[model samples]
Target: MAEPTGAAAPGFELPLLLFAGFRSIIDDLHRELAEQGHPEVRPAYGYALQAVGRDGATASEIGRRLGVSKQAAGKTVDRLERLGYVERADDPQDGRRKLVRLSPRGIDVLVRSAEGFDRLRAAWVRALGAERVAALESDLRTMASADAFRLDATSWFNG
Candidate 1:
């Protein structure tokens, strides 16, 4: 490995640092989820579940939301169904449409994810100080794109 030259990091380091922070938080969250009885949980599941939402969505809708093909969304739905995270229901408005709704287990994972994120934020507060964290968040909010919180990022990244 090369030693540090004591020079400022390359421009690429900015995005790398941001991605590393995201990866660290996600890794931590998955570890907690596995320990909390969601051992099969994966990041893709979280994104798909979010796309499904409590109101439910069809595979086509999910595909659009996820920025993936319908077949890809269907495959994801198949896995989620087998894992008991979601169930298919006949759409009331459209007889031919099947809505993929979250099962109780699916809700549990979302709940747990929220709690885990809260705990992680608290840890960040402790490590970086609340004000610094808050400022960082503020700066990110200002710098981030309007669609930064969109659910298609994972699929977009993969593509």
Candidate 2:
């Protein structure tokens, strides 16, 4: 609803507050994930991991999904490999291409992440009550488009 006439205009705090809320949830998730032995995981790694998917993907494909250059995606893959989070294999369909697949460690981390998010959501339900939380999620869904639900959100948001 619009503010009444003569009311003060809104500043940037609304967006900032929304971002802060998101940052808080993500930060809490990461903290818990670190405690679970994924201290090396970074925020960016989640997007990269999602892009790699269960079927595996090439650096180029991951790059496309992540809205990053192939070189950048390859670097991320290299780091993930060193961290034991992913492994590269020769692509069966294309001899010249390599597919980046999540290793056991990667799969473990993702499983842990899902559990962590569920716990976090449950905590929110406890604090806000289930109906309010459900309404909040529904409202967010109403505001956000399916097209916005992409791993390439960096470019989507920036552009």
Candidate 3:
């Protein structure tokens, strides 16, 4: 039997390690959020919350921004409404359409979440030092905006 053969394994580089570190940090953030009070919240919920921020939006518009079907967007809106994080009403401009917006309670939740995130960020800066943290953020942003780093191999955001 011939022994399996392959090129010598390349040692882990800084970029690979940084990517792994980022993945771990993201997972930890989600876990922390769940432990804090949003155990039922999912990624889709975050996207919807972001969409419905002060501007308010319709399910169709949310779907367009999130790359989901209108039905999926509506379902997410329903879930958020049930959680008391969002409200839906007839669009003033078009009574036939509905618009969704964050409720006062939802605004409170968002504020608290921002505070918690600030604490988390501060801890990271204290641990990594402001300069290193700044450098890491700059590198991440550069990569995030690069076409090769995008989901469709283009860019992360439209604007």
Candidate 4:
């Protein structure tokens, strides 16, 4: 029997496919964010921003969340501060440490990012239908919850 001309080979890996899909989504989201007056924030920066959160977080905490060294997290914070997306203030409880929080501009960026994600998801829903999208989301969440799939920003950020 001959192989089908256009079909994928049996050696295709699901992880590769998932990575490609994720990259595509990030690209689209980045483009959307740029279109909405929010640019210069890469996916890695987005992850760092998320680690900072709303209330605030210490550089050490962000480092732990991002799976990077404290110095690396400080560099990320430095870049974000230079970009006017984050501010560091003295920690009230500890005079020696500083708390990192998103600036007003950072909040705007996050809002725009959310809008971009919504737009991307909406497009996917249009193509795949809401039911399929929902199922896919559920499955992804389930897989993500597995202990084997640890969330490590350093792995994703290549740092």
Candidate 5:
């Protein structure tokens, strides 16, 4: 066996750092949900819930927004339906397609997740100062708006 050596490991990038931060926040939110007696919820499920908002949406739309396949989105919907978080109904405009919407229980989860995010934001503000946090938010928004880094996801909305 020969020892092969190549380039050194890459250093942390801004995207990776941001993703790590998001993961941490989501993990905290999941823990909070569990503490509040909602243990079936997961971070990925939140994305699906957001995609299927009050107006409801099709699995194909969700998959497009989430950067996943239609089958993957359908599976997420199925899991959520099994968990009593969402309901699927035939689309009025297209009987062949189905629209998914959050159930009352799913709404509760959404509310709790919003509260969790607020709590996390407050903690960050307390630790880093409001001005700094505001500046960071603005910078992140600017970065997101850049033409080179367009993100097309409905995860930001409380859907």
Candidate 6:
């Protein structure tokens, strides 16, 4: 028996490639976080911390920024709170909302992680040559900013 055309081959190879790379990066980050005494911390928590900002953010705002639901954002915040990486305080202007901010421990972890990222970035730059690396970054950013590619990208500052 012959197979049907559409069902004969699985498509979406390009999206699968993207998914593989994304998953690998997350895995690497988890390994690094484990080494830093934060085995429980996930990449989502780091992203949430970055989005929370200095003034802090409400769960709804975090959900919007992270492309998650408010309930999910609140759950993530709760996990971070248990990890001593974030804290929730009363939002002075709104009794219904609580402001989520990085705790001192969170800041320390973020700084350390950033330092590690910078070091790895420098290695990549050296391996690729500074000029080539710069050009590659620019090209990637341009592609990411294009209408056709922008929707596939997660953040404007992703590069």
Best by lDDT: 1
Q: What pairs collide in candidate 1?
A: none
Candidate 1 Cα deviation (angstroms), residue 159? 1.0
lDDT by residue for model 1 (29-110), tens: 9999999999999998999999999899999999999999999999999999999999999999999999999999999999
Per residue, candidate 2 scores C-alpha lDDT tens digits across 1-159 of 355479665777667767877888889999999999999898788888999999999999999999989998899999999999999999999999999999999999999989988999999999999999999889889988878678986555655
- Mind giving the per-residue lDDT tens digits that candidate 5 earns over 1-159? 222359543464556777877878888889999999799887778878888887999999888777777997899899999999999999999899989988999999999999999999998899999999999999888877555332234333324
lDDT of each: 0.94, 0.90, 0.71, 0.85, 0.82, 0.74
- TM-score of candidate 4 against the unseen true structure: 0.85
Choose 2 or 3, whichever is better by TM-score: 2
TM-score of 3: 0.72
Provide the lDDT at 61 for model 1: 97
Writing each residue's lDDT as its tens digit, candidate 3 over 49-120 gives 876768789998887766667897788789989988899988899999889989976786667567766776
Write the residue-wise lDDT of candidate 4 on 31-149 in tens digits.
88877777788888888888899889999999888888889899989999999999999999999999999999899988888887898999999999999999998998888745544
The reply for model 2, stretches above 4 Å from the true place, is 1-11, 154-159
TM-score of each: 0.94, 0.90, 0.72, 0.85, 0.78, 0.72
> Cα-based RMSD of the predictions, in order?
2.0, 3.4, 6.7, 3.4, 7.3, 7.4
TM-score, model 6 to reference: 0.72
Query: Which 10-residue window in model 1 sums to the lowest lDDT?
Result: 1-10
Report the number of the highest-TM-score candidate.
1
lDDT of 2 at 26: 84
Which pairs of residues collide in model 3? none
List the candidate numbers ranked by lDDT, top first.
Answer: 1, 2, 4, 5, 6, 3
Instruction: Find the 10 residues in a row with the least total lDDT in model 6.
Output: 150-159
| Candidate 3, residue 66: lDDT | 67
> What TM-score does candidate 1 get on C-alpha atoms?
0.94
Q: Tell me how many residue pairs clash in candidate 2.
A: 0
